[model samples]
Target: MGTLWYGGKVRTLVNEHDIQEAVFVESGIIIDVGSKELLTSKYSKVISNEVNLNGAVLYPGFVDSHLHMIGHGEKLLRLDLSDISSLVDLRETLIQHNRKLGQGEWLIGEGFNENLFNEMIPDKFFLDEILSEQPIVLTRVCRHALVTNSEGLRLAGIDESTLNPPGGVIVKEKGVPTGYLLDKAQDLVKGILPKIDRKYIKRALVTSLDDLYQHGFVGAHTEDLNYYRDPIGTLHTFYEVIDGESRKFRANLLVHHEVAEYIMQDQIEHDYVEKGSIKIFADGALGGRTALLSKPYTDAPSTNGLAIYSPEQLSQIVQKARKFNMPVAIHVIGDLALEYAIQAIEEHPVPSGKRDRLIHLQVTREDLIDRLKKLSVVLDIQPRFVASDFPWVEERLGEERLPYSFAWKRLLNAGLMCSGGSDAPIEPIDPILGIHAAVTRRKPENVGHPGYNSDEKLTLFEAIKLFTLGSAEAISNENKYGLIKAGYTADFTVLSEDLFELAPDEWLNVKVEKTVVDNTVMYERNKD
Candidate 1:
C-alpha cells in the first residue's frame, strides 16, 4: 500500500521552481511526485493512507553533516553552563547541582565559555572555592579545553610536576597547576572518571535522536566512539536504537581515529546505520586560543595555537585509515591546521567511492581554497558559529584575517563541496538557526547590525541546500536522499511556514511541523 502526501508546497530542491503539489510513497520510497489531482488519481487503487499538509511547506529531510550524538544527549543530562555570563552564576549553579548529586559523585558540566564570563579565564582557584572536597570538571564550549577543581586535579594525579602529554597542555600559572586541561590532556581526568554504563549510552543515543527528530532532522553524521570508549559496543547500541522499527532515524557514524581499527575489524553493518569516515583532530579550538594558526593570535601574541598532530603524524594517520579502506574526516579550525590536513590528505588519498572531509574550516586562505577545490573532500561547516563566535572572534583573528576566516561563500564560490551542521552541544542543533546564521551572517538577536562580512552571506536556497543536498553528498547518499523525485527515499522536513517567503530575521520564529523519515512520521508538532 502507498501513502499520498498532498496539499502543501513540495520543494524538490532540484531547482528554485521545482515545487510540486503531491508525492506518493510506498515501502519507504517515493513512487511519484506531481500535482495533487494527478497523484491522487494515479495511486487511488494502491493508496492506503493520505497525509494532509494543511498549507505547510515540505522540503527534503535535513541531515546534520557534523555533530556528537552522545555528547548532545549528555549535554541534555549534564549541567549546561552555556548561558552562564558571570563567574558568580557559574559558582551558584555548580553549588546547586552538587547539592543534588549523591555523595562522592563526580560533578561534570559542559559548555562553559570563559569569553562570556566577566572575569575571563577561570582557574582551579575559582572552582576550588565552590567545593574543595568534591571533584569538579567543567568543559569549555569547544570541548577541547576543560577546567577542574583541585580535587579533580588530585584525582587525576595532575600537579605542577605533571608533564603535558603529547598533543596536549596542562595550563599552569607561576609554576603551579591551574587545573585547566587542553586537547589530549583532557583524557587524563576523563580516564579516571567512572565508565558509562551501556544503558546510559543507549539512553543518550535514543534521547539525542528523538530530540533531533523533534527539531526536524532526519539523520546526522555523528561521532561518538570516543564518548563510550567502546567502539564495538557503541556501534551495536546505535543499531539497536536506530532500528527501522522502534526508532526510525538515519545515522552515519564517524569512528574516532583512536578506535577506527577496532570498528573496521568488527565489520558490523546495518541498513539504518552507516559506518562512515574516520574522524581525527588536527588541532584544538579557537575559543581556548588552541586552534593551530600559521601566525600567532592577534590578542594572545605569545603563541600561535595547539596542533594535535604534526604534518608527518597526520599523514601517517590518514595513511592508516586508507589502509582500512576508510575516509579521514579531519577537524581543522585554523589555517595552519588546514595546511597539515591538506598535506595529509594529499599524501594519502581516500578509498574509491569515499570522500575525505575537513570539518570546521573556520580559518582559511585563498591558496588553501584553490588546493581544497582540487581534492576529493567535503567541507563540514557550522554556520551558527558566525552568530556565536563573531564580534568576539574578531578580537582573536584581527581585521586582517577577517576576509579569510569563516568564508563559506568564498569556499562555495570556489566550487568546493560544502555541507552544514550545528556542531551541537557546541552550538544549538536546529538547522533553522544554522540556516538563519548562513543567510543573515549576523547574530539573530541583533539582526540590525551589519554582518561581520556582509558580502559573504549565502542565499536562503544555498543555506537550505547545505543541510539537504550538501549533507547527503557528504555521506555519498545524494542519489537516494536529498530530493523529492520518484525512487528517492520518502523523507521530508515539514515546516509551519514557507522559508523563502519569510524574511531572514523572522526565521527564528518558524516552527517544524513534521519530520518524516523513510515513509514514517517520526515527529509531529503538538497542536496544544
Candidate 2:
C-alpha cells in the first residue's frame, strides 16, 4: 500500500511524445503508467493512497552520469570567492574572512578564476598584505590552480630552488615561487593541513544526497571518489558510512586512475562497497588552457594544450580495466585528449565489456566526431558549462574554434548517445538551468550572449533525453531511473510548465514544481 499518482502528464520518454495522465507506485518501483481511468482501475486494489498531480508535467528523474559528491558537498565548508572578479574584490573579501579566523592558522578559500580577474594573474604579494600573519591558500575556480601567501609557501618549502612536479606546474617569476600551483603541483603544500574529518564527510555525503535529489537526480556515477590520493577528502569516509547503513540514494563509485591497477589486481573490487567503475583525466579544461588541442589556441599562438597521458599509459589502463567487469570513464576535454582516448580504444581494441565510456568530449574537431561514431563512446556533458561560458568562449578559444566546442547539436545529429550533467562544484548543479541552456543555447536569463556553438542546440525532447535516458544508459542504470515504464524506479520530477512549449529564450526561467522519489514527495515548492 505505497501510493498512486494520478492526473499528471507522465512522459515515459521512450517515444518522442508519450505523455500519460497517471502512474502507479509501490515498493519504490513504478507499477504502471496510463490514463487515470486505466491505472486507477488496474491497481485499484493495491493502492492504499492516491494523490492527484493536477496536470503537472512529470518526467523521469534525471541521472547525472558524472558528478563529484564529496567535493561538491564540501563547497559549503570553504570561503566562497565566487564574486571575486577583480583583485579589488578578492582583497576586500579575504581581508574580511581572515579577521574572523583564529591567529596563525590556515585561511583557506576557493572559487577564484584568474581569467575572470582584471589582471589574469594574482600573485602572493597581494595575499601577503591583505591577510597578514595567516597562512592562506586560494584555489582557482577550476581547482587546477592554487595561490598561496608567502608564509604558506615558506611553510611548504616552495622557494626559488623548488622544481615543478611532473603533470603539475609551480608558477614563478624571476625564479621565485610566485605562490601559484597547477595540476600535480597542488601536493606541494596541501600537507600543511590535515584532511577534513571523517564525521564531516559523513554529514557532507547525506547533505549532498538531498541536494542532488532535489535536482531530479536519483543516482550518479561519482567520477573520482578518491582523487586526492589521501583516502579521506570526504569520499572514503562517506563511502564507509554508507556501507554501514541503508541509504535512500544510490551512487556508483569510480576508483581513481592511480589506484585502479592495484585494485583490479588485488581482488579489490569486491573489497569495497559500491565499487564497480573507474575515472581518469585525459587532459585539462579549456578554462585552464591546458586541455590538449590539435592546433595551438588562437589566443596563445605559441602552444596547444598538453596531454596528461601517453598512448602507452592509456593503453595499459584500457587493458587493466578490461580484466574486471567495471566500466571506464575518461575526462577528455579537448581534441588532442579526444584523439588520445580514441587511440587507446582503437589500438588496444578494448573488449566489449561493461559500461566503457569516454566522458567530457567538450571540444573536438569534426574528424574526431567522425571517428567517435566508430567507437563505443558516450557523452557525459555539462550543459550548464554552455550557460556559464557563453560570453567568454569566443574570447577564450577564438571564433574559428567555437563551432566545434560544446557541439551539442552535432552530437545529436551524429546519432550519438548523450547525457546531460552539471559537473557540479565545477558548474552549479542545477538540472533545470542545464536543460534551459541546452534547449536555448543561451545563458540563463539570456543576459550575456548567445552560447558558443549555438547551432548545437538540442530540441526539448533531446535535452530531456540526455538528462534521463542518456544518462541512465551511460551507467547501465536505464532500466530503473530513465524511463516511466513499469518496474522502473518511482522517481520523477514535476515542472511548473511543459518545457517543450516555452520560447527558447525563456527556458532559463523554468522552475521545479516538485521532485518525487520512491513515490514520496522529496521536494516541493513553497508558495511563499
Best candidate, lDDT-wise?
1
Tens digits of per-residue lDDT for model 1 on 349-418? 8888878999999999988998998788999999999989988899899999999999999999998889
TM-scores, all models, native as reference: 0.98, 0.91
Q: Number of clashing residue pairs in every model?
A: 0, 1
**Per-residue accuracy of model 2 over 1-528 as CA lDDT, tens digit each:** 767787667778879888788888888788888888987777778889987777678888876767778777767666878667888888888888878888776888877876666585677888888765668898777766788889888888998888877667788888888888876777788766556566766776667776776666666667544544445343456455445234445566777767765544543332224564667777777776777888888878776776677868977787667666555688888888888888877765545634567777778888888887887767778787776665665666787877888888888799887878877677777777787788777765456666556688787888888888887777666776689998998878887677776766665566677777666666677531
Compared with the true structure, model 1 gives a TM-score of: 0.98
For each candidate, the alpha-carbon lDDT, in order, equals 0.91, 0.73
lDDT of 2 at 501: 69
Model 2 accuracy (lDDT, Cα): 0.73
